[model samples]
Target: MLNTQWRVLFVFIVLLIASALIANHLTGRVFNYHDPIGSVRAIYEDIKTKIEMAEESELTAIKTIAAPSLSAKTAMQKHLPQADTTRCVDVSLGKVKYKRNGNIYTWTDSNGVPHFSDEKPDFEAATLDTDFVEPLDYFELTLHAANLPPSFTEELRIKLNTVFKVYGQIIGVDALKKVRLNLTVFATRRSYEQAIKLRGADPTNTDGMYFHSTNSALINYRNEQSAMRTAVHEAVHAVNKAILGSTPRWLNEGLAEYFEYTKNSMQLVSVEPHPGWVNNKRVAQSVFTINWLIGLDDTWQTGDDTKLYASSWAAIYFMMDSNKGKQFLKSIMLAEQKSPCSKLTAAELKNMLYQHFPQLDKDYRQWLKTPFRKQSF
Candidate 1:
């Protein structure tokens, strides 16, 4: 009985030992009871949540870093003005911006047009070096006499106004309506002569040329009638420039002579045809002599220096008298805008003259042969 009881006890101890080993194996393979599988699963879920949160945080950081750069670019685009794309590259001092349709400058409007802005750059003001008086529409004459005769200046102004009226009639009064004529008289002939000589011109030339510098015309006081004629002559030249771009040098000097001699006198005059006429006689004498004679052609040479004044006066008179003469003058004026006189040939000019004044061919030829009484002023 004792041996059987001991055997049972040994069996029980072996069974207990085997049970312990099996439980250890099972725990290691399936559940891992020492490490706790549920705890490991909870740790994995926490790690995954942390990883997702980290990713979101990194994305937010990237956006925050990029926001300012994008905002800055947008702000710059909004602040900048557009530019004028139609115009060639603008070198003007202003901020420029390019657009789809046109370019806009910072200082200018949508069409790249300028505005009266205090901050805007002054284009005209910057270039103006001298004290410039803006032109007036109508000028009131105030003749202050020093050494010059008061009558001479007064008569000069009257003759000037008359020639101005003549040209105004031809090219419309509105053309010269805005021109301001200021005539200042000088006491000494030396001053007037010095002024002319400075311009590389002869002072004795009765028809004084226009001075573009001051817009002021000067005439010497020799006699009232002569001074009046000189004033009218110069004033016509100025009027011609106002109406027509510029009267040809020949036409200009000739017209000046015409005004000097005629001045509203209705008399038949003949012109002498001589090469030395311009050199020997005064401008008035040369022109008057030629007006009395005939066989003169409208085709005049450039810088002929002889008979220039005479031929010019006759041509101008011929044109002024004919129906188509005025139209031809207009054509000549228009042509001058495109080309110089040297470019036009003698034949072309002759054809133009004939086309304008067909009656000139016969009447002028007959007038040249006929003798007329000369009227003295």
Candidate 2:
């Protein structure tokens, strides 16, 4: 929506420039007796004023329709008082439920895999290090929490940073330099549910969600690893809302699941598919054809079927693995952001697939037969 408004403003600016040029050309011929400079100045000012009003009206409509709460409206208004491109406000971390004590603990488990915890470890070898706190301005993502363990918070911050880095590289870092996505994580499901209720959204059976109006992702801290995955998933939504306006549900959710796993390496610098940590093999085998997957009516609104999730990941995975695929995905993302008021028809989607992947049908079959490999990056 924001991107649409800016595009509108850009058109207005171009029109203004053309108008000025025409006015200058006509002034001498139409009114030779009068001062041409003064007439052009008046015309320019009038056009500028009208453009500003149009921009304001568009913003007002967005505020009334899109912002779900009074707080959200107020925040949008405060941050976006005008249509200044460089002054746009990307998303920021909104709420933190727990206070920071500035402490971090390091310990090793029985398997010798090292772990960090906010609480002091029972192991005599555990060490407390208060010196290595994550600075607030050090990264592109901010993690807000409620009663979360400091160690877990630190882990989330680190992992989410890696997620952002990997995602930025995949999508092109220059495209995302303007986004600052935020994630609000709660220590318990009870707190997470309560927060969503207060915000006027149904939690339903969802473990995580990203609110565009509020510009933040929310998650409940369940099992540490699972919670991190949830956080990464929702973070994808937040980033998409900021950078791409609105995305198709398949691409949105697939990209989230793609980044939800921890492969013991934070540096995922390549496009090779991670041996997806999610249990999606059965679904992939069932929905073997890309045509069958895209044939499902209303692909954008398809609900949380395991088959849908697996197929979505497969589609994105296939796209991201090659340079041509990455470029196509990038073009789609830019197009989606540029068009907030338009909807892509089914025929249009099919044509787009063929344009980008001429051999999609044959290639997809080959992809299904190939064994999934754990990513080296």
Candidate 3:
């Protein structure tokens, strides 16, 4: 009915109109185009849900990480006993709490002595004793002397204090003053055994022990002499821990063995020489040499604990007897203390001996063959 060009234009317009109608229909059906605002609201709701889920997941992760430390603190709190403020001598029963009473207060004097007061003392250097003992300059002595006589307990306390003072001198006054010791003496063997059981240690194996976790030492007092010697032996380990942080296994046991035979008198306290009764017999039978001692491993596990102890003690004794060795030992101790993470390696010990005492190897061999002699501290 029209010209060719006009007819083609009309057909094209009709096709475009039909395509638009189809597109609108498809969009409305598939995309909910009629409720455009609702579609946007659905999308926002999905995003909100995902964000909330992510936050919840993050919160769960945080809780998982924090749970163990919280449980550990709670467990420690449960295991340790509460503090008692009524007594003059406070025992370490868990964390030391310095709660003030009505007007009667407890405090430590400048000399690190604990005292009670109705009014605040005139001393400017007074600190709360119970809290300060474990945390500061003074060592804490918790004596459970329920079965022993009161006089004996009092005397024992004095002797132990003297031991601490002697240890301070050996390590250096300033070094020892930085840390505190926690010593627990069980009055009877029964109580000591009970404590060993509670602590998950073998009573048969351990007569005295130093617990690193709690920074405490435990001893069974059989009599005056035995208790004192044992305390000194354990205290050496404690001193090492406080100052050097880590000591070689041989040196640690060796020092303990060497120091165990201390002679305590009214005038002085000294580390006496070994009588050779405990370890000398074993040491005498074994092939003893400087290189052998240095290279010796499988120390305690090889069922040669007695020999190991003797060898260690003998080595320490030889070194300690010499003035040069004393200075060398002091230098190493100071170095180790300054760097807490450092350990006493075998190489370092050998190198030090070589530097300080070049003929140490020869001297040590000669000393090993000699009989044990009593030397004054």
Candidate 4:
């Protein structure tokens, strides 16, 4: 009876040892049991909370940074009043019938009738003839009679600052120094059309002009937004004049178009190649058709006038499309500065361009092939 009792006690002790080993293995502990699950859950919750807090802090920082940079109100006040002016010229078709204000000349028509208007009959359409007189003294900001809305002048000024900032960054210099702009806002289509006629008649004649100066610009205010776009385009012209001085016509128009289409955040969003004589197809056609007659050197000077502006803009766009294009443009500007205006013919300019940038032609051709994608401002 004693031996049987001892055997039962031994078996009971073995069973207890087996149970302890199984528990240790399941808990991943060889010698002791530990509840690691609770600690891991606690760490995970702590990390998740910290991540969310960091995101909130980042948003607060952005707001703080953005608060002080807005100047829409102040910019408007300074620029709106400065842009008002009227541009008119007196012209005589025949002998003077009466002369009022030594600047104004009146004449009689061939039919023995007296007529009076602001401009002379002999003056060509779209041209400013010195023979025609302008009574107003030149001001920095000149607007045609009743052209712009009171609210838009300030907005236009702010946009101008933005354009200059971006342009200066791209060109690596202060472009405003070399260029000055005169903004002309015309209220009615008649005034706008009249201004266009005056300017168009003598495209090459620069006397008694509104925007005839290379360093200066003139714009029509179709609306506040159109006025802004016009400002951007003209501002770029000012920048180009400052940075590159006198550029090839193709390049000049191209760079202007580039800025016209590419400078605004809105423009980049919906960029389509301009069509017709003013843009893409006409420009490309000019290159192919005129390459033989004018050659690449003089192509810019006397190609299809319509395409010249468009193609030039395309070329500028191509150059600004990538980092390489930016660097190449910088080099071109440097080369231009070194070359004297009188000595720099188209051929010499082209040679210099090739010398500095072997890939320019190739890259330009490639840019012509690439599809355009519009961007929002």
Clashes of each: 16, 3, 0, 26
lDDT of 3: 0.57
Q: State every prediction's TM-score relative to the real structure.
A: 0.44, 0.55, 0.54, 0.47
Give Cα distance to truth, residue 136, candidate 2, Å.
Answer: 13
Clashing pairs in 2: 97-145, 97-146, 98-147
Task: Kindly list the per-residue Cα lDDT of model 3 for residues 130-211, writing each as its tens digit.
Answer: 4322222244555544555666555545554554555454555545533345666787778887987797765544557777
| Per-residue error (Å), model 1, residue 41 | 99
- In model 4, state the lDDT of residue 279: 38
Best by TM-score: 2
Which portions of model 1 show Cα errors greater than 4 Å?
1-154, 173-177, 182-187, 198-207, 262-306, 333-351, 358-362, 370-377
Better model by lDDT: candidate 1 vs candidate 4 = 1
- Give lDDT: candidate 1, residue 103: 25
Q: Superposing all C-alpha atoms, what RMSD in Å does each candidate have to the true structure?
A: 38.2, 17.1, 20.7, 25.4
Residues 1-377, candidate 4, lDDT per residue (tens digit)? Answer: 99999999898667555545543544333432253344344444555676788997898788657655423322111110111122221111111122234333356667987655556567532322234322121113333425556655555554554444444445543222323455565665456557656654332211112343323454544456556555655555554444445455455555544544433353333334543223333334434321221145354322333344445555655556666656656666655544414224556555655665576656566656656544222
User: Looking at candidate 3, what is the lDDT of residue 261?
Assistant: 71
Candidate 4 Cα misplacement greater than 4 A, ranges: 1-145, 174-178, 193-216, 220-227, 262-302, 337-343, 356-362, 374-377
Comparing 1 with 2 on TM-score, the higher-scoring candidate is 2
For candidate 1, write residues 210-324 as lDDT tens digits. Answer: 5644444666654455455555555555444434433345555566665664433333232232222223333233343322222233323212233455566665655565446
Q: Tens digit of lDDT per residue, candidate 2, span 183-210? A: 7878777888898888777665566766
Per-residue lDDT value at 300 in model 4: 35
Alpha carbon deviation, residue 332, candidate 2 (Å): 1.2
lDDT of each: 0.46, 0.59, 0.57, 0.45
Model number with the top lDDT: 2
